[model samples]
Target: MSKRRQPSPSHPTTHHGDPERSFEPYKKAVILGLRWSNDDLDLVKPQAALLETFRIQCGFETASLVIPSTSSEEALNAISQTILELRQKYDMDRECTCHMATLFVIHYIGHGVSETEWEFDICGTRRPDAVRIPWSSIYIGMKSDVLILIDTSYSGNFLQPCHSLQRILQNNDHHAEYLFSTGNEISDQNGPTYDKNNNFTTRLTDLLYSVSPTPVTVAQLHEALCTQANDPSTKLRYTPQYMDCYKPSIIIQHVEKNDYIWKIENTTRKAQIPTGRALISVCILGNTVHGQVKEWQASLSTMDSDVTIEGVFNLQGYSLCLLSMPISLWNSFLHPGYNS
Candidate 1:
């Protein structure tokens, strides 16, 4: 007779190779500041100042500042040149080696009519009504991991086309890219105010500074700002909104062991005794009648030996054994429930 072989281990295993860690060299950050309204230069001034401070604090290997025409025709030409330079440097052309480490920080501090149109002063004249910052334009020559900050009316509407937090989490690319907005619906007609004590940009700047030691997720930042804004007396309300609309059907390329585990949990069911039992019985059902017959006979094998045959047969109906496999084999069996 042939000897039986023990089954191999069923659990998935992972091997971590030799650890080779290296720090990423300092990257460049391009700051695009668009402050169109002359109504509150004070409110706008700090935004630009905060950007400069953020750049200095980041200590990047390289940085560029682009301020479009907030005042004159000359400003328009400057803005166009700056935009062109940025496009050439970071756009998909791959012309500049610096492009790989570049992070475009487009800051729009003006007024947005809706998701599509932003009214900003290209020149001091304010003759040109509203310019559209197409989603294509925003992501032009950059990686998908860009960080965008817009402080304007209807800024929240911009996220109307991006993916939501729930989708992002489920899809496993929660950190692919992020968008941060200062208000919801639309900027209040009451021009942005700077409460000498605290302002939106300043508070955010402080938060970023504090976040150096602890990396903050986009969701965490949103929650923190919301909590502060809810308070009644907080000098400057920081209303941050995450763009949850644009569901680009791109399959996230990067995959980690954790990502697979997360996907399995979202897509599969937890192991249960009844489920396991059902699966085992189903698999063995067709193999032999002997086990089924024995199970039936055992059900009739009651404690009371004195019980009559009729009584034993009656008890047999209630004595059926629900077979179950070991917990390790749960994944190997067929799924018990409905399919997606």
Candidate 2:
């Protein structure tokens, strides 16, 4: 029998130096087209095609589509099932090692009514009356990394108050998400108009096809749409006010990050500490070793550092804390010190 060597008192035992994982290539996307009138199918078809182009450009391994021409219930059910199935198949805990991200795009091209309450006729059936597709339902079952696009009138209803697209984009979670819409809370009675030769759909189709070779960010796409909307000669009435209402709603519960975790303490009030105070202790853990740990105490009002951690030592009165440590060493002290 071999005895396990104990880790040094100053150093914890663990592995480190693993490169940060990426969540891009493994993304999955689904585009749902609801209630596109027969007159607008010509418009809808191209949008669907554009989505496929995005699917390919983004390298999404799996893609699905749902369109309801007449029955809203059937369409909602199909979309819901597709979401559920995809979530289960590529969930984080699944045995498969593949990283899974998802994008859901819902486009409702039809009439919207807000007299009694917010409602839209998606494929001839009223949404709230015939088949309700709440924001919660549509976004349910989603893990950390997901993007949602809602191209419809009154799409702002899907987003909760105070949540903005900028904030969503700024989120540091590895699995960040986004949501966008084609218009604001108001509905356009005339709907989208077609051009003499290429309608709104065809133009969008052409743009998407041409832009496929060069991958563009969501902001770029929005800029393109805005430019098209602002073209004075163009008959198309798609305005930024109409298509840019959808913002990002970050569900903090689903944030994904590396092993390093952060917690804000005494955030309401600032901590007062004297200058040049010595740190009590320092600790680190991870696979890779030999990295130096650094710490600094900020001045009461200025951004200058009053104290810092350099050599190993034990001091009194001042706060003792770990700034940064190897992942392996950090995990050792995570649990109550125990023997195996």
Candidate 3:
């Protein structure tokens, strides 16, 4: 797909104040799974299937293509053609009242080079048979939202070093650009076994399924993957990194959940909308006493009135608090013993 220039800002779409109506804009979803060899294709196939199923369930007309061979120029051409057809089919170029209802999900599992030279080589060599395509060559224009999951050696190279969270929050028509990767370098791939179930895609798919029945955003998915990576049992080598600029946030999966309350009835829980913003998780080491947890939450909230405790959960013998704080306090908050 040819890279196009950014378009002028369009009118803000009105969603009629209905939360569910926000997701109704998406009409079509295209999933492209790229792999190097037949062995990798076998794995990519199932992963693509899982993604396709999720997209379909989200009420979008979905199409999936598992393109094999890192060396085949034909494969690249196929991807380009598919993107072209998608643009035409969705009338992505036309400036309508709403953003284009097209979601592009790409999964690339192969060997990648540095960030500047963001190219994938079949055998990591510049041989005649090996096809090396730069990431810039791929169509990542501003027509639709894009989610790229890369499991390459230097997959983290795809990420932008810094992002503007405020821009994402303010811009209503801003289509998302999300990149989730294994790690930046080979050393980031730690641990022993990197088998079928232990690889990045496997762990990703697991979280995708586990978070079902609860609509999950890219930020939530990345946080879940990081939790899995820290766990020794999951066998996930590298911690995944996410780089996104999504307005109103992008929900990758949508599943219906019954609204039921138990003993905590008539009580309202602050809905933590994961906007893929600046959220930090803090762990407090201690018992599970309600008073103690409340004290910690109070102290943190007192320090910065703007700070919002997104979620609180216990894990690995410690209580964790997911906090949304102003960027100004990030330096002090990130330092060790700052709370103490």
Candidate 4:
């Protein structure tokens, strides 16, 4: 966790640490997907889906649901319940040998305001000022790290989202880190191009699910997010910021090697494949090349095809090994049928 600064003209997407597939430090994780009520906040569902996919791939077995919280009451209740659960888990872990930290994730998607201050636009009727959730209450009582992935422009600073978030974290007490998209408010006036998430939501999920079975670290995730933000074609107003509340890369997720197995098997592929791997999609974590690196991994999966894979992997025959057993079911698993 470092202080905020403008990203360099050229920051390589390659990571420089050795991370494992298992989300070690954090033994348990809870993803609370806040489905923002505003129609313009479509990024909510996909944001939740990315984390839900990451946790499951990281070998975590939890019964948490990733559905959007419709009303403010539902949102607050979900937040309360999540914090309480983390507190209990933290207390219980204290008594155990493997006193691992718990990862509390909150995916907030909707019309968020940071112009005069920071808050989420729940509904247009009272959108800008009505429903404001204090930052402290968001993770109160929890004794572990909190990772909040907000899909909103100007999350901390309405016009200067990064700077606002920086000042807030400078005086924050909780152990947390946030990944926010830097852009203008989403309204009828020059709103975000949600159509082809090839640059945003798509990259987000791909970055996490890149190396399945192999753990993906927070640092690595941050690097990928930054890479996308820095790219000019995305038309992002500000460089996406990855600010931490004094924590480390703890949460990790692993998906699969072939047949594009993962992230709500039925999850739709709204973006075109960015690699040359034919219909098969592979996410390269760490370095973009095949080399002997400690933090190297790739999570491969197909988006719209249900083809049978009859391949034999031999570690002796190749540098990378395939551990698709865990996600073998996901290889051909069906996405929970949706009406989209």
Clashes of each: 11, 17, 0, 15
lDDT of 3: 0.48
Model 1 residue 21 CA deviation (Å) reads 11
Ranking the candidates on lDDT from highest down gives 3, 4, 1, 2
Off by over 4 Å in 3: 1-25, 37-42, 66-73, 94-100, 115-129, 140-142, 153-176, 183-193, 253-340
Model 1, range 1-340, lDDT digits (tens) per residue?
A: 0111222232111011100111122134455665543423344565756566555544321233434434344445554576567756645233223224344555555434332223211211212343333222232334423445555433323445322322222233232234444333223575444242354555566665654433233334444555566566774544444432122111111111244231111112211111111122221222333455465445534422221122111132243233332222222222423111
* Quality of model 1 by C-alpha lDDT: 0.36
Q: Estimate, for each residue in 1-340, the C-alpha lDDT of model 3 and write its tens digit.
A: 0111222234221111112333334444566566554342245554565566555444344555544445457666766787777667765554333444556677776555433322332223223344555544566453566666766544323343312222221232224444444333323345333344456776666656554444445555665566566677765665665544423335554433237211111112222332223477777775367676577568766555656778878778887878775332232221422320
Name the regions of candidate 2 deviating beyond 4 angstroms.
1-44, 61-75, 92-111, 116-139, 153-204, 241-340
In what order do the candidates fall by TM-score, top score first?
A: 3, 4, 1, 2
lDDT of each: 0.36, 0.35, 0.48, 0.43
> Is 3 or 4 the stronger prediction by lDDT?
3
Error of 1 at 191 (Å): 10
Candidate 4 residue lDDT tens string, 1-340: 0122222222111122243312233445566555444445456446656656755665343334332335556566766776576566645234211235556666655444444433333331224444544444454545545667655444433334333544443345335566655454545466654333543455667665665544444544655555555567866435444554433444354433246333322122221212111122223333323343322222122322322222323343243222222121121122222100
Q: Per-residue error at 112 for model 4, in Å?
A: 1.8
> Candidate 2: worst 10 consecutive residues by lDDT?
11-20
Q: Which model, 2 or 3, shows the larger TM-score?
A: 3
* Model 1 RMSD vs true structure: 18.1
